[model samples]
Target: MTRSELVTALAQRFPQLQTNDTGLSVNVILERMAEALTHGDRIEKRGFGSFKINFRLPRTGRNPKTGQCVQVPAKAVPHFKPGKELRDRVG
Candidate 1:
C-alpha cells in the first residue's frame, strides 16, 4: 500500500493513536530508514526484511534512445532482501 494508506491502516489498528500521530510516526520511520541508507548503514527488521546499499562500478552503457555509447559513473544503490519469514509468507 501507499504511504497514506499505511498511515490509515496504522491508525485503524491502534485506535488509541490519532491519525496525525500515526502519520507522523510513519514519516519519521521512513525518514530514518532513508538517512541510514544514505550513510551506508544496514537496517534489519527480523521478520520483515533488510535494507542495505550496493555499489555499482563505473561502466559503459548504451542510451536506449539512440543506442549511443555513454559512460556510467559508479553509484551506491539501496537494496532490500526479504527475510525468510516474509519470503515464506509471500510464497
Candidate 2:
C-alpha cells in the first residue's frame, strides 16, 4: 500500500496515537531507511526482509527506438531479499 494508507493503518491500529503522529512515525521510519541506504548500509528485519545496495557497472546499451548504442552509467541500486518467515508466510 501507499504511504498514506500505511499511516492510516497504523493510526487505526494504535488508537492512542494521533493521525499526524502516525504519519510522522511512518516518515521517520522511511527517513531512517533512506539514511541507511545513503550510507550503503543494510537493513535486516527479522521475519520481514533485508535491504542492501547493489552496484551496477557501466555498460553499453542500445536504444530501442533508434537502435543506437548508448552508454549507461554505473549506479547503486537497492535490493531486497525476503526473509524465510516472510517467504513461508506468502507461500
Candidate 3:
C-alpha cells in the first residue's frame, strides 16, 4: 500500500494513534531507512527482507532510439533481498 494508506491503516488498527501521529511515525521510519541506505548500511527486517547498496561499474550502453553507443557512469543503487519467510509467504 501507499504511504498514506499505511498511515491510515495504522491509525485504524491502533485507535490510540491519531492519523497525524501515524503519518509522522511512518515518515520517521522511512527517513531513517533512507539515511541508512545513504551511508551504505544494510537493513534487515526479520521475516521481511534486507536492504543494501549495490555498486555498478561504469560501462558502455547502447541508445535504443538511435542505436548509438553511450558511456554509462557507475552508481550505487539500493537493492533488496527477500528473506526466506517473506519469499515463502509471497510465493
Determine the C-alpha RMSD for candidate 2 after optimal superposition of all C-alphas.
0.7
lDDT of each: 0.98, 0.98, 0.98
TM-scores for all candidates?
0.96, 0.96, 0.97
Off by over 4 Å in 3: none
Please, what are the lDDT tens digits per residue for candidate 1 over residues 13-79? 9999999999999999999999999999999999999999999999999999999999999999999
lDDT of 3 at 62: 100
In candidate 1 the C-alpha lDDT for residue 22 amounts to 100
Tens-digit lDDT track of model 3 for 1-91: 9999999999999999889999999999999999999999999999899999999999999999999999999999999999999999899
Lowest lDDT 10-mer window, candidate 1?
75-84
Which residue pairs collide in model 3, if any?
A: none
Candidate 2: the clashing residue pairs are none
Better of 1 and 3 by TM-score: 3
Model 2 lDDT tens row, 18-87: 9999999999999999999999999999999999999999999999999999999999999999999999
User: What lDDT score is found at residue 85 in candidate 2?
Assistant: 99
